[model samples]
Each structure stands twice: as C-alpha cells, then as structure tokens.
Target chain A: MSNLPNVPFLKFIYKPKNELEKGGRTEIPAPRQSSEPERRCPNCYKSVPLSKISANMSMCGCGYHFRMTARQRISLICDTFEELWPGVVSNDPLGFPGYVKKLDTVKVASGELEAVVCGKAEIDSQPCCVFIMESYFMMGSMGSAVGEKITRLFEYATMNRLPVVGFTVSGGARMQEGLLSLMQMAKTSGAVRRHSEAGLFYLTVLTDPTMGGVTASFAMEGDIIIAEPGAMVGFAGPRVIEQTTGKTLPKGFQLAESLLEHGFVDAIIPRPEQKEKIGKLLMMNKAVN
Target chain B: MANPKYKSAYEIVKTARSGQRPTGIDMINGCFTDFIELHGDRYFSDDRAIIGGLALLYDIPVTVIAIEKGHTLKERTEHGFGAPQPEGYRKALRLMRQAEKFKRPIICFVDTSGAYCGIDAEERGQGSAIAANLYEMIGLKVPIISVFIGEGGSGGALALAVADKVWMLENAVYSVISPEGCASIIWKDIKKAETAAEYLKMTAYDALELGVADEIISENGLGGDEFYTMLKDKLKAAADELTAFDGLADARYKRFRKFGSYDEITIETEEHK
Candidate 1:
C-alpha cells in the first residue's frame, strides 16, 4: 500500500544471541561432575535430583514427564506414540559431496535418524501431525530431508485441524549440502505459511541452537514461541562474532534471557517444566476445538 | 559484541577492501553506471529488499542485483524489513533470466539474514520464489557471479548466490546455518555459539575449502576508498575472466545442473526409536 526504500532494513545479526550460551551453565564435561543437578523431578520439591528421573515418565517434581532430547521433544508433542510416522529421515537430496557419509555418521553417532522427525501425533488426545528437530542429529542442521519432513509436516498439520507444535532444535541449515542446504530456509518457511493460513495455531518451542534457518523461518513464524531456559538461539555464534568483529560479546549476548530482554524470546521454561507449560498452552488453544 | 581487540565486521571488510564500506548504492560514488531500479514481483508489490536492473561499472554493461537494506525506517517496512519476500526473488529471477537471454553477465550483491520471515511474504509464496531461484540459478545459461558484500544468509542469499563464481569479503561469512542456530540446536544454549561457530565452519575460509566459494577477496582496509577501488577492479576482472570462457554460458548452466540431488541408494532402517 505504501512505497518503501530499497534496503535490507534488517541485517542478519549473524551471531544473534540464544539461551544456553549465557545461563552460567558450566559444562560438567563427560563423566559429569557430582556437583551437577541429576535427573530429579523438575517441578516437584522432592530433591532426588534428575539422575534418577525416568526418561519417559513425568518428573515427580512438576508431574511433567516427557522426552528430553530434540528428537524426543518432537515425537512427544507432534506424533501419536503408536502411529508416529517420521517424515523423510536424513537423506542427502542435495548430493553436496561427502554429505551422505556425514549424514550417516551423524545418524550413527546420534542414534536419531535425521535432523528432524515429523509425522502424526496426538496432543491432549487431539490427533495432529508434528515436526521435531533432533538436536542430536547433526545438531539438527536442516538438509533436504529435514526441510522436506518439516514442509510435509506443516502441510499435514494444516490439513488436519490439529495445532502444529514444532519442538525445534537446530544449528541452522546443513552446510554439507551447501546451497541446497541453504534453500531449506525457504522450503520449511513456506510450509509454515500454509499452516498459518488455516488459522490453526503453530507453537514453536525454541530449543537450544534454534538459530540460522530454523530461527529465520518457522521459529519466528510461531503464533507463540516458547524457549527453554538458558537455550541458545541466534544466526551467528560468539566466537565467530569475536573472530569476525574482534569484539567480546556481552556476558549474556546470545542467551535466552538476553533475547527476552530484546523482545526476541517470548518466554523461557526449564526442561522439567516443559510438559506442563506445553499442556497449558495446548489447553488454552483447545477452546478452538 | 563490542569487543575491543578486533575490528568490527564493517571495519574488517572496510579495512580489507582498502577502507570503503561496499554498501549498496554508496560505492557508486567512486564510479558506476546508474541503472534503472526495477520494483515488485509484479504480484502484490515490488519488494525493496532487492534492487536489480541494468547497470554499468566502468562502462562495462552488467546486470546488478543488490539486496536493499532500505535507507530509512519507512522503507524497511515496505521491503518486509529488507528481507526480500518471494516477490524479491521473483524479480531477481526475472532480471537474471533477462540477463541470460541477452547474454549479459550478472553481478549480485548479497547481504540479508534470510528470506523475509514475515506473514505476508509467505502468503505470497516466498518459499516458491526462493525455490524457483534455486532451480533456475543452477541452470542459468549466463555467467553469474555473487559476492557476500555484507551478510550472505539463508535462502534469500542462496537464491542469488547459486553462481559460477562466489566470492566473500575477508570478514564475510557464507554458512549453511548461523552459529546461534547451531548452538541452540547442539547445546540448547545460544551462548555456546562461539563453540558452535568453530564446529559449523561458517567462514569464508571454510566455504573456500569446501569448494562452495570460488575465492576470498581480501579487502585493503576497514572502510575507505581503497576497498571500493579493489572491489571494482576485481569485479571487472571476474567479469572479464568469465567472459573469456567463450562457452561461459554453457559452463554456467552445467555447473548448476550438478546442483540438486537426492540419494541414489535406499535408506536403511534406524535404531533410534
């Protein structure tokens, strides 16, 4: 309706901040130190610590039991357990050279088939398709497979009346595939569009590393975007920013807290409290049914 | 990110370029032809995110696709925050195709985080436009060259950068994903971006090593005239070099033909249930 200038009003703050980076999370290192908080119920006051918490069962603390990894997050929210159908597993549609081997290797090591797992699932007993990015899978860097799965997932989510919940954890697009990998940003974002047109809610949970392609598209497209506490989200990283610009980023530059300060992240939830938070959000949207 | 030890990204590129910020439109001060600025995807409206048309650098004819970051706040809104919507890419494709039809060489200046991630852009088919670019650029029968003059990011940058000769300023980065995205995915903490950047290998040097980028131009300074001078000369040389191929159009087309691919073998079953 109005004439605009010819400039990219926005530039990729290449290394925009995400959460996990700034939460003072000192790595316990492999063979995690005893000082670390073990698997205790995230919500309950019981101090058993997390080490003993069942991976599938809800935390005794907050009565919220759900899968934790990026892959699990998707299945838990998007798929029906008995009929969870994952879309195209990590396949190198790009043939970007050595990308196949890299995918295989990453798959073998991470135990997740691909960077993203998408398919039919039930939320609050409502059958809806879901797309979860396995952070474990190549750090959830979107290759053609990830993109295709997500694109299809959105298509399916909109086709069905079920609200779309994307438990996203990604490093961005897959670099091994080069240009093809970069193209996923459009493919996946396109799916987000059709899904949004139906007026069905699309909930984007910005897990760790939800930057680059993931953030640039669906993560930003969510009707409501919820981030986990201390999660990292941004386009570029601190070291690269440091190396490129020769500046030390602020103490909490890429942290979720920092993003909240910048009006980037809507809210930050701890892992243990995620299920309840998700359940509540789903219920609020349930009135649409 | 105001670390004192190193020059800013703008400074680094300016320094490397011999002290000129190679921003869109600004570099023309030294010497450049004022090409007609085309607008819109011919759909809803022309996006200011992309500025394309016939231009001359040092009297040599060229088709230029400059990512407009918008000069003013109002301009940014019209262009979808300077992130090209599908229309921008469509317009770019139109211009690129035009250049190919006339056998004119194309020069693209990329500096966007990604395609427009806004509501309207999607409704109008941003994805399709980007996809069309991917499909077309690879098979374009013209000598196409792209430079990450500022920030080469996501699908928006890739749409124009599917070129025979891709270049990045010393400080420019061409990455499959951003470090923040990577850190968030791997560590669930955006703070781990520094560690992730190293792992993702998202730098000009990395792209060069991977054969994704053809060359890395070392700018002479952080910001001044020398950089622009070098840029024009180098760009001119690249144009000349591409022109010398004789079968440059065919070569460019073949280069793109080798681009899109899926697996040749069947996928195996996985155990990560």
Candidate 2:
C-alpha cells in the first residue's frame, strides 16, 4: 500500500477500461473495427476472424452473438430496404455539458447519425416497416432523434397498413437529453398503440442489453415479443436491482432464457435462425390489404 | 413544516418525497365519494403499491388509480414505498380498461420514486407491464387525466400517466432519473444532487414550461379539505372538457408525439450520393 501511494502515475495507468466515472470522458473503445482482422470474443475468449464472424451473423463459433451495427443487422434481415428520414439529427436541446462532443464522437465511431435506423423493407417478399437500433451509438440510447425516427416509422406503417418489425438494443433513455428522452417512452408507445389499433402486426426482437426506458415502452409493446439468445431484457438493469434490493442476483437473472422461463418473451431465437423465424411470422401475419 | 413561497427545485423534490404528504388513499378518500376499491390484475396477485378503483368524480363516474406511499413505516413497507411492481401496473390497467368499457373518464394520482427494482418484479415482466399501459392508455376512448401529487418517478409513474392532460402539484417533481442517482452516476458524488435537480427540470413549473405537464396545481393549504376540493373542481372541469372533445386518442397521440426536440441535418449522405 505504501509503494502504491509512492507511484503516482500507476493510478492513471491502472484505471479499468469499463470505469466511466474515474475518467472525465464516457467514450468506450469502439466495437471491432473493419481494420482489425480478428476480435476477441467476450464469452469464449477465442480470437475469431472478422470475416468468419460476419459470415456467421457476427456470432462466435462458441455461440456468443456479437453486437451488430444497425446497417449490418438491416442487411442480414431485409431483402430490400429503403432508408427513411436519414436527414434527422439530434440537437443539444438542454445544452448539456459535453453532449455535442459525445454525439460527434459516437457518430464518427458508429458511422451513423443516430442510434436508430428506420426504413421500409421487405422480409422474404413480405413488406414491412423496420427499425434496427445501433448498439455502437451511445449504447443504443434513445435520444430525441432516435425517438422521432421510430415514431415517424410507426406512423408511416400505420398509414400504409404495413406490419412493423423492431430490433431493440438500448442501455436506456439518453440522459443528456434529460426528460425529453424519458418522454420518448410515451411518444413511441403512443405511436405503437396507434399502429396496433390500425390492425397491423408489430413484432419486437429484443437484442442484448435492452433495459430502462426503452424496455418500459415500445420495446415491450409488440404484439409478439421475441428475443435474441442470451439477451438482457428488463426495466431495471441487474446492477441497479442488486443495489436497490441489497441482495446478490442469481446467474443469468435478466437473460432471455430467464425471461422465457418467466413467460415474458415468446421465444429466444438465435441470430442465424432469426431471419427465417421472423420471415415466417411475417408471412403468416400478412395484413390483408 | 415550513412552506416557503419560493422553493428551489431540490427543495421541491425533498418536499415531494416527505412522509407527511397525502398518499393515494388519502387523495382518493378526499376527492371522491363512494369509492369501491378494485383488487388484482387477474393474472397475478394484487399489488399494494397501486390503489385503483371506480369512483364518482363529482357526479360523473371515473376510474381512479394512484401509487400510494403509506404514511406509517408499516404502511410504507406494505406499499413498497410507492414503487409499483408489474402486477400493480396491471391492476391499474385492468381498472382503466373497465372504465373504458363503461365510457367513464380516468383520473390518476402519481407518486413514486420509480418502479420496484426487485428480482420478482423483473421476473414478472415489469417492462412489459409499463409498456402495455402506455400502449393501451393512449388508445383509450375515455378522457384521462394524471395529477402528480408527489414524486413522478420515471417509467413507473409514466405507466399510469399517459393521460390526455397531465397536472402536477407545485411541490411535486417528475424526473427521468432521481437527482441523487444522476449525481452519483455523473459526478461520482451524491452531494451534487441539488445541482443535478436544477439541471433535471423536474419541478412542476419546469414540467409546464417544457410542455410535459399542462397545469401546476397550487400547494396552498396542502393536504387540507380546501386543497382536495379545489383539485376535485379542476379535475371535474378538465375531464368534462376532455369528454366533450372528439378524436381523443389522436389528441393524446399528438400530445406525446410533439415531445421530441431535434434538429434537421441535410448533409450529403450515402442515400443522396
């Protein structure tokens, strides 16, 4: 302890990567870049080649599903996609400290203007409105732009009498936007309800780490809700729950398997089989125009 | 208790969470007569955190739902300190749907720190329950009004608050996250909560300015008969006005849809290129 106190620079050098508060910045290391040939799997710890992982829908050989970008997920599921409202961008409404800088950084890193990508697409010849949340963009936080895009998409779907498919992977509402981000929960849910009332099918595919406000809103408002294998889907994050309850959580407490056991999620579909499963459901529930 | 004419946002937050404040049961008993309390969500056990039932709002029938934080410690424990579980929300929804069946207006009293963060709540689909309310409430044909009598905490409060009109007491606070939680997360210190409260825009006046709430009820003679009587008059007036309007669902939809604030960027992208 005396030697550690003497080494002043050691504290800075030994800081943990996941610790966001110690560092003034909230920037996480960008997910596997294209330049990197192989990336270490968080689950299996095997360094898998990028091309092999991409070919396997970003899943490691050990069955750990890597988080895919919005575009990447779109390409996998949508046979034909026409992007909608690509020009919408977020503003620092609250003028929150460092918000614009954080947005810029994430925009460059994620190569997306916002966390969610909404578009009209076809899944196995069935037409639908689709939205894929970008996990790389601020951990898929629902800011104003994200909320507006999804709400607009749902409105469009309702008007067109089209089925809607949403893939949610969010940490929660973007706190930088303050209460506006929280209001998105009600906004998106209102749109979803309108779409549902129009007699259109809405299916939500909850990806890993779908928690907080998003979970408490449109992500859980689907007519049929499914989840990716081992996805964490809950209103409160496990850590927050543990802190509040002051009790140790069991293993895989909020995982998709656990949700399925508790009758929350309809099914836990693996990434590779998702397209077929979703396509079949879409095909079955085709709205009679 | 000192009733300051000018309370800071943090002070209002503190006051909203005070134990002496009128709970849901107290409000229900005060505002309405012949209240018949409804129990259970049918799918699960009745949650004590939420008190919902049918009541006569002056002469008109209305469904009343509120998140009750009990006055006594034993009562608080029974009510889970006003933090609702999934079943509590489900029970509220059940009463709401019943109100819709009878073409009755709905009035909700919101007071909660947030949803219950427990293993059982998660297992029972707390997220889904709140989401369901938001979805269903928007499309409900009847007029709905939510009054924030105390702390309107996050999604738990929002579950019962997707109303045509939202009101907040002068001392009440509605926030995305608690000031203390925000401080601890952002500053790594809980002592910065006062500053966090200022930035959060959680006060009733702030809520009105931000368009999150329509009106701010005064706290004059708070918890007294006159306070409840004035609130009842306002509730009746608002509900009557809302009931007269057509296309309520669409209005409610627009109310929430217009909440987002963002800028448009016409930069050359892959699509344009």
Candidate 3:
C-alpha cells in the first residue's frame, strides 16, 4: 500500500502491448488478474451495449435496456429551445405526528425543494404547465405543500387558460401528517375541477410505482392518461394486491401496456416519442393557447 | 354524571361531549331505537367496513347502510383498510336492494375515500361493484339521505352518498382522490400534502359551493363529545324533512349525474378563439 503508484500513470505504463525498453532488451510484465473483463452476454457477445439498433430500439448485447429516469425524460422532450421554467417548492405546516422531522431529513438527502418540479415550458414551444415529480424524494410522497403547489399551478393554468402536463411517481400518502396529509387529495382535486371548468387541457402521465394517493386523485383524473412502457400505475401496488388476493397476478398486471389495453392511458409513450406527442397535443390545444 | 350534565342542547354540542368521534356502527346504534346489525351479500361475503342493518331514526323505521372508515390498525384490517372490497359494496347493494323492496328510507354515512384499490379488490371487480352501486342506487324507490362525516372518496363513498340529500360535516371532505396522492403526482413528493390540501378545495364548504354536497352541517358550539350527537340529530332531522320532498328521489339521481361530465376549451382559444 505504501508504494502504490498513481493509477492513471500505471495504467499507461502497464499497457500489455506497450512493453518497456530497458538496457537493449524489452521486458513485459505479467498480465494482472484484476484486468479480467466483467460479465459477458449469453447471446451474441459484444462489449459496448445500449447502443441503439434503430430509432426506436436499444440494441443491448445482454438484450436488456434500463428504464429512463425523470431527468432523462424532460430533456428528451425539450431539447435546444427547451427552456425549463422556474420550479415551485413546498414548506412544512401542521406539525403533525412525525412530519416535520421527516421533511428536514429528506431535504438534505434528496436535495430538492419538493418532489415535483413545476414550471412554464414548451413542447415545441407550446405554452404549457409542466410538472415532473422526482421519485427520489421521500418516494415522491405527496403532502399538503405538494398538493397546494400543484393546486396553485393548476389554478395558474386555469387563470391563464393553459394546458397542463403532469408526470407522477409516488409511494402513497405521507402518513405522518394524518388527516392533514389526507386533505391534499381533496385540495388538488378541487384545483383540477377549476382547471377543467376553465376549459383548460390537462394530461397526466403515470410512471413506475405510481400508487396510493397519486392514483386515487388527479393522477388518474386526466383527460388523457399517458404512461411509459412497463410503468406501474395503480392505487395499491401489485405486490400488495397480490398478497391480499393470494393469487398470482397476470404478467404486466399494472404495467403501462396493461393499462393501455384496458383503456386507462391513451398511449405507452416511448421516452424518445414523449416530446413529439406532447408537442402535438400542445399544437392541438394551441388554438385555445 | 347525568346529575351534572351540561344544560341545553347547545351545551351537548361540545367536542369532548363524548371524547371521540362516533364510529359508523356506533352513531346509528346510539340514535336509533331498534338496532339490528345485518351481515353479508348473498353473492359472496360480509364486509364489516359497511354495517348494514335495520333501525329507527326519530321513531321512523329505516334501513341504514354505512361506509365505515375504521379506526386503528386492527379495525382498519378488519374493515379492509376502510376500503370496501367488491364484497362489501355488494353487501351494501344487497341491503340497498332489500331496502328498495321494503320501500324503506336508506341512510348512508359515507366516510371512505374510495373503493378499495388493492389488488384483491381489482381482481374481485371493485370497479364493477362501485359502478353497479352508482347505477342501481340512483333509481332506488326509497328516499336516500347521505351524511359525509369524515371522508367521501371516489366510488366507495359514492356508493352510500347517492342519496336524496347529501350533507357534510363542517370539516368533512369528499373527492376523487386524497391530497397526499395528488401531491405525490403533481409534486412527486408526499410530504407536500399541505400544498395538496390547499389546492384541492376539498373542504365541505367547497363541496357545498360546487354542488357536490347539498349542505354543510353546522357544528353549532360542538366539540368531540357531542359532535356526532349533534350531527346525528341534525342528520335525522334533515332526513325526516327530505321525506316531505315531493321529488326527493329525483334529487338523488341529479346529484350523481353532475360528476360525469368534463369541460375544457380548445387550446385555440388561448390566444384569440
């Protein structure tokens, strides 16, 4: 440990093909066992995976492509001229039960004001209210603050006569605030009513583990519910439901594909296609916009 | 302590008049003269979440079917988390259809957010039960009066709330979803439920204005003890008055029809439409 050389420098010197020339003779060091490559694909062996074979397909050597994150989502839809609006946040109130303490701890660990990021942005420059929820914060649990922010945002859209796009990801109610936490569902639902009353457009996108309060309220209340492929969107989760029923759920029970076939979501939007479709919706609503 | 009881009906309306809110079963038991707790839907099983029975409110014989949002973990489990599975709603349906057969007035205390959304519920067809309730309850021959005491969520609450007159306690809430759920969707954070609360406009007052709830039950100097007592009395009085309504049954159907429509202007109007 005491004589360990710099890793980058040793990496260059230890190149097996580049042997050192010392005293008129070339000396090659034995290959390090640590240099062995990691897991290989059982299928057609390839090193660089995740490279797309076509526009809509991800060609992975292992035949596995990961689900997209919320950040990757927004950027994909709104590139170049995509200007994300300033975000809204939540603060604590109703020092009920263990809520105040939980919020304090979550803020430092999750580094976001609220789980959702809301602002004015465009799908191809369409003036719309965009809200994207981050699942990292307290499992994107919704409380009064989150509820009120969304209500105000909805109300703002209502007042402005703008369309709204919401992406949801959550575990369930905060549960810490008790009745106060339960109150948010009504609050946001009311805002949605006002928004709909104003003849404004609103779309809800459900994502992985989108259960509990989110599913109960406006997440499922949209005119057009959209979901990413394989996303789970329901009130109680599948596992909990399975445990309660004691029957094995059909494959992709609450998955986006299932929801689509069942007529819950209008489409299973690919990550790449999300922007274009939203832009198209914005365009359709543009006459009102 | 009857010797030292507070004087006047107003005094009885205190929060600690009883120290806690009355359970769905308890509320009916205390007010009614002959309380008979019935069980089960012949189709499947009984649901304790909704206690269906025969009772007399203010000397009037009636059938009561209530959506019980249970208290405590054990009660919650027993009540299926206060979310009526298909069986519970079906049980209520059986009772409702029976009430219709007897031409008895139906009294429903709604305190559930919605039908159980658990997997067992879905597999057993919770949505179908809820939809069936909405459909059948609307045309029941008997007069129906619904009281929103705690929560009235989605189809679960609606199963009971499809009544001639829907009344809400000053603090009760009724909505398609709860605020925490909305916040989770809109903010991606459940802790921001306070914000969700502010946004949903879910207060009884809001429902009253929106035509969702017909009237709000004024506490009238009430606290925990007498809250339910005063509420039950007021509810009893209200239900009695509704029977005098020439078109009470029609009113019930109209109330539910309001939730069906969605109104939104085309985006073309955003600029100049």
Candidate with the greatest TM-score versus the true structure: 2
Better of 2 and 3 by lDDT: 2
Top DockQ: which candidate number? 2
**Candidate 1 residue runs with Cα over 4 Å from true position:** A1-50, A53-67, A74-79, A82-87, A91-98, A286-289, B1-260, B263-273
- DockQ for every model comes to 0.07, 0.46, 0.08
If both were scored by DockQ, which would come out higher, candidate 1 or candidate 3? Answer: 3
Candidate 3 lDDT tens digits, B38-114: 99988778877888889987787788887665556677678765667778888888888998798778888777756
Determine which window of 10 residues in candidate 2 chain B has minimal summed lDDT: B264-273
lDDT of 3 by residue, A30-104 (tens): 374346444343345554423343223332444433344445556655543222322334444333344456666
lDDT string for model 2 (A1-289, tens) is: 1223457788876655544544434354546655679989988899988889998898999999988888889888989898888878899987766789999999999999999998899887889999999999999999899999999999999999999999999999888787888899999998888788788999999999899999999998888999998788988988888888999998889999999999888999998888888999998887776
Error of 2 at A131 (Å): 0.5
Ranking by TM-score: 2, 3, 1
Interface root-mean-square deviation (Å) of every model = 8.8, 1.8, 10.3
lDDT value, residue B65 of candidate 3: 81
> Please, what is the whole-model Cα lDDT of each candidate in the order they appear?
0.63, 0.89, 0.63
